[model samples]
Target: MQATKKATINIALVGNPNSGKSSLFNALTGLNQKVSNFPGVTVDKKTGAASISPTLQANIIDLPGTYSLYPKSADEFVTYDVLVNPSGDEQPDMVLIIADASNLKRNLLFCSQIMDLKIPVIIGLTMMDIARKKGVEIDEAGLERELGVPIVTINPRKNKGVSELKKMIDLVAKEKQSVAPRDFIDSAALAPEVVRDIRQYVQVKSDYAALHVAVNHGELPFLNGGQKLAITNLLQANQFNKTKVQAEEIMQRYGRIKHIMKNTVVEADPLQKQLQTEKLDNILLHRFWGYVILLSIMFVMFQSIFWLASFPMDWIEAGFGALSGWLTNILPANQLTDILVNGVIAGLGGIAVFVPQIMILFAFITVLEDTGYMARISFLTDRLMRQVGLNGKSVMPLISGVACAVPAIMATRNIENRKERLITILITPLMSCSARLPIYTVMIALVIPNKLIFGFFNLQGLVMMGLYLLGFVMALLIAALLKLFISIKEKSYFIMELPVYRAPRWANVGTTMVQKAKIFITDAGKVIMIISIILWFLASFGPKDRMEKVTAHYEQLKTAHPEQSEALDMELQSEKLSNSYAGVLGHAIEPVIRPLGYDWKIGIAVITSFAAREVFVGTMATLYSVGESPEDNDATLREKMRNATWRDGSPVYTLASGVSLMLFYAFAMQCMSTLAIVKRETKSWKLPAIQFAYMTVLAYISAFIAFELLK
Candidate 1:
């Protein structure tokens, strides 16, 4: 007889937050995953391929962690929809339920829920070491018998028992998975009439799945208008109370889980390891010392961004400079050559030069998260956050804004209250993101002196830290002001689980840094290059008559004095750029920005940088490169900006103007990506429109004040 066919199947990793689910996923599908948003949602979906055996393979889906089937946030909505009614690529054929053995009781609640969906499931036990340290012993075979599913203990961090888990996965996949085991809790008992009615009204997989349909049929992506209406009618006719049903469901599941644990697990006095976790928390969570340590840590992180990265940043800048010079000397001189050397390469240089700093920043953030310190930050600031109409949950998104606003805004899904979430999304962009790092560093280098203070602290680093603090401070103030308006009010709570402190996973930190670097160099680089090319066209050519007139005027001078050919040619290029199409556009806004200590060239950069904040650097590079000769290719962007002058030949980028530019970016809604995510998250154009207007006003007023006072 022919062997049965072994087709690739889907295996979703599902669990509660901090359950080590993602860690196991990383181990199983190392360097094989890609991230994309789930269909019709902004939430990220991480999928990877895993080989279960020589002839068997499965696609792995890492779902967002949730406590239970009933969801309260947008993130949870994605998890629920996928587990209950997956669509397209998200369909789950078999599931690996990642459960924390150390917190097995709480973990079983989610595991039981996923099983009731009638899908095949295997419980991959994690944190067994931590469980043993707590003097808790569990019979895996006994628990497996009681749960009626295969159980495998795994430590993805140390690569323990992973092969056994994969063997179980292969065994499960080879079997026909059409029939599921008995329900952990008889779902018919929850609301028999309503469940039956919905089950009849719509063909669902199980009774519990029908109950979810009754509870949230309207929001489920798969249900159509007719089906949703029918379910709604059934729910109303039965007078179903969603809150009561949800609460009762949790109580019944826990009761069963407690019984299962008591029969199969034994406990004694916890070892000193558990005690150490508590001891560390005492110091890290101490009110006074916690705040001080947090500030000190932040100060060092920001300082290291500049200090540790300076060497690599300079090397990258110099490499680009040398490449541009070599290309200019060898490549044919024409419009294409000009675009290649100036537009593409210069834009690329602007993006690459700051990657070291971006990597350092992401590395610091990732370490904080992996060490479990990030959660404590939220706890420590919960009260202060409450004063501004936010809670601890809002702090994560705000802090994440330091890396990028798009994901930070998406992070607001954790904020349960509508008003607080919206407020958090609106102010998140005010926190300096990595995209702003280039602008800040360039401006800071030009204006702030690089000197050490008190023999240890760096002056430039202090200014950098101050700028970050300013972003956080301004975000809180804006949240306070926004709270006074917007009448949607609701009760808010900050319920968080502080995980046990462990040393950071350096591998994870390194992976994050590499991913962020690739994203900046590729995704951000593409946008900057495109904009630079467009800007180059406008800056290099002009109204035919004016361009020709300038060329003719410079030609006559060069002829009159052949010995001054090089100098005259330089003047000629500058004159032509001043009369070009870009010059006209910049001049159009020059009047409005003049009082803020900006020239026409600065005006052009400001207008074009609305595409993204980092585009400011490329814009400056392209703008400055237009008037420079091939012999001047070695000059760095900072050097070019330093040499910039107004029409009167007076320096344009003085102390007042450089600070004014930095402050403008610190407050401006210059990233269309951030604004777009805000609209998507809020599902409203009005909020983003309002956000743009208010931020523009704030930027102008703040920059005007800075320039006026400093001047």
Candidate 2:
């Protein structure tokens, strides 16, 4: 008997937003997934391996969620490019199209488009419970016959029907058959002569691919210059009008869909009462109550970050401090010991201690997104967004900015209006991201009293909320001002589908929280460690002659007054730091930042943190640990910072200085990653340069005003 052959098959999972596609991917791949960027694009490409059989395995590629094949953004363009160009790297052997059973008509639009590509396709009907709740039932067998593809109803969140779905996928992969149902649209009539000409020039799988080549031949990556010119000339010669063809094709496809729905789908009533989603929205999306609820939610989220995560944060800080002291005691007195204890351990501890807060923030965000409340947030803020010259869709990116601005800026690609998209990108960094949390928490702890207001609300928590609100308010004001300068003729609209509210998936939330924390430790931790080592070197050694003279001077003082030896030792260390390379750089910039109530030490942190905002905490940890004795090594970073004083015997972290620094970070565009992403998204340095210039000016002016007023 011949041995069974083993092979790898590529399966593409495509779906609309909120269609449970990602959930299915997670169920299938579990911990086997890897996320990277698509070639030459910043759009995320998530792929994973799933074993279908003992000898057979499938590589699942989770394509970005898009409405249809018509590309509107860079992300959609990726999906369109892969589907049309069957010979590309991402070309699929079979397609698993996830359809929301609750809204099959709209979901099937894209499904039908996929079928027309002549790929081997299977439909995974998700959200069955949601469909039943809405009093809708789908005849899966009849619908399968109508669409001419295998259909399986799966609930990945509950692991129901997942094995059956896997069996179907394995069967389809082994069969290697293409299911091109001819029920959707008459592709030949859409572009007859043009399609015929394109098929002669390229290996077209179906007439739909031919039509796409004719319409998009100029930008298609598969077509060379000669083929592109030939197709372009052929299209012009045949009088192929793309817009007219697209409209006709959509209308014709929907007409057929209407007929299919009548035969294979059933609904209880067209004039049914309000949906559960609608009832909830009545309260959550109310004009007056919505704003109040939104603010309350924001307050609670910030409050929880401080209140809930404090114990874990304190534990982490205490653990690191103990470890540092232990290492200090064991290690010999040398430069290596100082580098290991003061630089590596201290820097890592500073950022790692904040992991609990970051995890909690991400968990809350995940719950909001998964429960469908995030969409209503957009709906609630649409009017206010329009007042700021943005549409409702901009709210997603703006809210996402609270986590990170790089992906938030990428999210702006979905906005069709150029002027609105640009404005959103410009203002998104103002949203206090997780990176800023470390700085804010550290500063607030040092300056703001840990007291309660009204015997309930924590004052420090309230200040944190106020900082977030200030960022949001400034974003709006800046956008409104920018709107006057940017002019465009296109009209903008926000058409979003609000998914039904469901119980928060605890597993998914946990996964997200862990993943976000891991990313911070792995990505930001590397930068912190490298900079810490370099900073230790810069702070440890000065010019050879200056160091010798300082040592000699300190020795003479110790000889004269042995009782003052310990006090004089600290003074000698401080004097050496003033002459060190890091200190010199800080002193150079101190003059400019002095008016804002920042000393030279803060000046160093401000300059170093431009690489990333979170590095400010790490910088502080390394700087503070450098001159401290071994006995004081066990103090937490907050305590160390609280005890810091300026030359005039004033607290360095005074309320005025803390507020000034917070305001500076709130408005400043210090993140290099954000700026790089902006350049990539806009495809120009002009916008990033302008962004940097304006944000720096705004940060300085805001800090100056805050310090002056508060002091």
Candidate 3:
């Protein structure tokens, strides 16, 4: 029997950041999506499938958003590579350029750059509702005539004109035709005889040739291999002239665009539209007031996550604990049940409990981005960012790094300066990620005394906020210092689109929150689950005689002391845990970590939790619970930890030790996912290795100093 063919059409969603590109991707792809690394780059490749028609399925790629074809950072290089390079798996059959209808000029500029590529191009005109509301009228036919690309005005949130977009794609794919040849140089500007002579001898006719002229004259860099050769040939033909051809090309295009825009584009009181957004922006983005407002908003976001989500977090933790208890009673006493409850259930549940926190963070981020407040934040913070030798664009990624360093690093694409972006990426992990939160929360609850800082604010919460601020301060200082060493001469400027103020799009926000949450729960969940099973195996079984001796010895100690037996039993169990397989492993690694004030059991938890920082709490729960098997009345993790001690009769978790541990986590390379992402982004094991080594050294030195000072 012959195999039936399945038709798959490839579509690329291209746009500038904050143009509702991601929202559209989520709408189109739904749940049928996969996130991977592009062939040789650390940039993320998001590919998803959607049914366009009964006979055709669309394989959609949400490419990294770029402002122009001139690549600046590593992320932009990846975006440029995937689109321009022919040797790729995810090349688009048709390019769907998404433009914000309200910001037609700026958006169209990017579209004009891509239109010259031979691929069939279509436009998804987003934010049409906002444009119409503002009395901005778009001549769709005029735009099509200017660019020769089909345009479909759609509100992605409302799901309007999406079918038309799909149909356009289907039709464009079937009939492969390039957009019209509108990209060209001013051959007419030259003398008639000179223009004719050059045209006949130059071996160039298209916009790509104009691009060469512009690049030679310092307009934009020559983009492709063909363009480079064409430039060389033109130079050779014209006696290797050193004129600013590239600069001339840029001015020529801009002049033409302005002319067309003036003739066709209609605005309902341009000054009024500009004023409407500016009125709100003036206060919000003021030098002093902007800082105050930004800080206040950040404070609210963090406070809401902790205070509001606490109820949900508690419910999740309690629910998981109850489920584990129920499973323990119902299942026969066996290794499998133990693994299921303590290892898989308890381990994974620890991460699940924090979903509310992650979701809240996402929700706030989405709202800020949707309402165009982020650009204002960037604009307001530019001076401060420049002082720190970084761009204002670096702010969002650094802030997002608090939630996760990996994505924050990926988010650095919008930064146009290469050196600045790299420096930002290097220091981002210094900001404590959300994965470190469980450990911080646990340790803070144990060590820090809850009292008001100035007889008003909660001391503990203030301390938490202090840690966050401290991280930001450190990042700024380090970046400033590092800038002195890395020599780069590119002029840095911040220019960003500040979209009109509008109510937050809940549909877009909700979709983003859920999609990111799902990715976190599933992708991180897999690594954690496997580690749980392995940890179970190591903790459960050991050498037969050693295990038997451990049990007999603990039982005998319990039998000897009647009143004090309970306490003695706990001590005996802790001792036996040091001799068990998992315990032995911790002991072997304990010497190396002893200077850092960590014991064998602590070492084991740290090592196991290297897979993910959040897993520290889960690792501690399983390691301590499995070894001690605390009685039903003393089931709380905090209570169990309170009773833990060293052989020298000192408490295991002291204020000094807790603070030291927190500092260690603050600077440590604990997240495996982060390492993987670093490798992807840098395209070399060398960078990841360097990152791991330096971070580890920093963690150790910081922890050592902290412990010694407190000791």
Candidate 4:
């Protein structure tokens, strides 16, 4: 037997948050990456494999973007530790230091810090086009001379210079090309007496050398063992001089950087860049027009989701129906056939139908982020958000919740204030998510009248918009209420760094859409499939006597009036369904909900839907299809629903019932996955349980009032 040789290399991509770091990672790795936890930490660890050539493959780790390796938040701390120590398990052969060419001054601080690690470093100079547009010119050779790294100008979105970047990585990894060490700033040289004094009270092999290494590598007290001991001893001995020494070092580093830029860098015109950004931001970040423009953008985004995605949604629905019909035709008449058509296919179909909506939502968000408008939104909402016990940055997550709660929750990681972040997370679910939109749309179409308002504007669209506004109001109120009780001093105020405006990156937009769609299809699809199958079995076979009665009724009707027999069979089958086991389950709970205007079947849907709100539509579609056995049509479903009557001879799905149902879904904690995620993120069952209880109580109260008033 011949053994296959395996090759491995470790590499890290380090850069600022918006410097096209993630875009580059996606392009290099393509679909060959996995996001998982790093050992015991909850921070996401993104790892991927990229084969630069047939003979060479590199294991890439996308580290969290940070300005310096000095640990702060948990996310940034990970990057600091990982790069400095380069664990025996992750001893990287090469480090790709990504920097935004446009923001060279700030980006180079991190680049210079990483060079002290003594690893084979390569520079991925991204956003070169933006840099050129801003009249900033960088001498690549000068940067290489100063930083001692191979610099490659890359446009990741366009895939420019990527191949060269990879080739450089291989050569550096193989030791074919050597990078000279830069003239790193020496902190010891700047403060020789302070270093001598620090060591007198503390212990280190060489005080000056250790302090120089610590500052060069951006090591804090925790990482520098001897420096930490010296700090403690110095604090015990008089600490006033130690504070002066630390501040002096920071000032010296900036001084050296300014001197280097003056000699080696060239600026086309410094005033021009500022003037351009200021002129655009005048209208965009204005006190009044800024808010107006933001609202208009939001309005267009929501309307486009509904109008633009209508065709694709229809195509998805029809395609699934045709496929399911074909499967039913080919399969033998048995339990397996029923499961295939009604269970697996139907469940998957329900989620598949919403793909277009999800894609559109993601696309809009991507464009906002790419054009740098999202940062402005934070600035615009900061004052108001502060009133509700949140930072300006909290606006990003709240707005994101309009699309989906999962990513919105992830966005909260950017909020530096712990108290404000907790408040934001606690209230984010109140924002009307895209998942809620489907349920809202179906109910609104069924209950609300389609009337023209003010000549052309749609009343239905306005109501949809109103629901969103109501959610926002509730979010603010709830956040304020929580802040009053869960008191924690807000330590940090919001400081947003707004990047210069630019055109949207369509490649990034498409990449994000694909990633979200995959999660929807795979993760959400599995749960829906299992639920669909279970519901199918429950509705398909009933009690023996009930099944016999249904068959006998159909037979008798067919013999007596053959011409009308088929319709009679379907009606009798539907009637017998009322006495089946599933029907008994629904009926058992109907009295409790009867005051809210729902019958037994809707009762079952309401119950099952508590597992996930979107499942409500699929549940009804399956239940009604099984009951009526009629052609699938929105009109047919509506007519069947309209004619459905209870023992009291009143219609079941009236406007009042639909309105109550809509209100219930709007406030319910109907997603188990969200609850689980909340528990995981907050690190407690206490918060999740409290959230579920409060939301459920609020839902019931709201639903009851809607039913009573509407009826």
Largest TM-score belongs to which candidate? 2
Clash number for candidate 1 = 0
Q: Which ten residues in a row have the lowest lDDT in candidate 4?
A: 630-639
- In model 2, the clashing pairs are none
The superposed Cα distance between candidate 3 and the true structure at residue 668, in angstroms, equals 1.4
Q: Score candidate 3 by TM-score against the native.
A: 0.84
lDDT of 4 by residue, 227-304 (tens): 556555554454335446657655766776777677667777655646466688999989999989987887777667
How close to the true structure is residue 314 of candidate 2, measured as C-alpha lDDT? Answer: 91
Cα deviation in Å at residue 22, candidate 2?
A: 1.2
> Tens digits of per-residue lDDT for model 2 on 1-711?
988876889999999988999989999998999988877677788999998876778899999888888887678888888888868988898999999999998999999999998999999999989888888999999999888889999999898999999888878877865485563687988877887878999997988888888777877888889998888788778787899999998998889999999999998697888788889999999989999999999889988999999999999999999999998899898888899999999999999999999999999999999899999999999999999899898999999999999999998988888899999999999999999999999999988999999998999999999998999999999999999998876788888888889899898899899999999998989999998999899888878888888899999999999999999988888888887888888889999999999988888988889989999999999998997878888888999898888887788889899999999999999899999999998899999999999999999999999999999
Candidate lDDT values, in order: 0.89, 0.90, 0.74, 0.73
Q: In candidate 4, list every pair of residues with a backbone clash.
A: none
Better of 2 and 4 by TM-score: 2
Assess candidate 2 and give its lDDT: 0.90
- The model with the greater lDDT, 1 or 3, is 1
Residue 283 error, candidate 3, Å: 1.9
lDDT score of residue 113 within candidate 2: 90
Question: Which model, 2 or 3, shows the larger lDDT?
Answer: 2
Q: Model 1 reaches what TM-score against the true structure?
A: 0.93
**What is the per-residue lDDT of model 1 for residues 1-711, given as tens digits with 9 covering 90 to 100?**
987565688888889998888889988898899998999987888999988888787899998889988888888888888888834458798888899998888889999998888888998999998888788899999998888888899998889989999988888878845234788888888899998888776667889898888888888878888888877887888888998998888889999998999999997655445467888888888989989999999989988988999999999999999999999989999888899888888888977899999999999999999889999999999999999999999999989999999888888887889999989988999999999999999999988999989988988889888888988999999999999997997999789878878899898899999999999888888899899999899999999999999999988999999999989988988888889999888888899999999999889989888898899899989989987988887789999989988878988998899889888999999988888888888788999999999999999999999999999
Best by lDDT: 2
Q: Model 4 Cα RMSD, Å?
A: 4.5
Error of 2 at 188 (Å): 1.2
Q: Candidate 1: global Cα-lDDT? A: 0.89
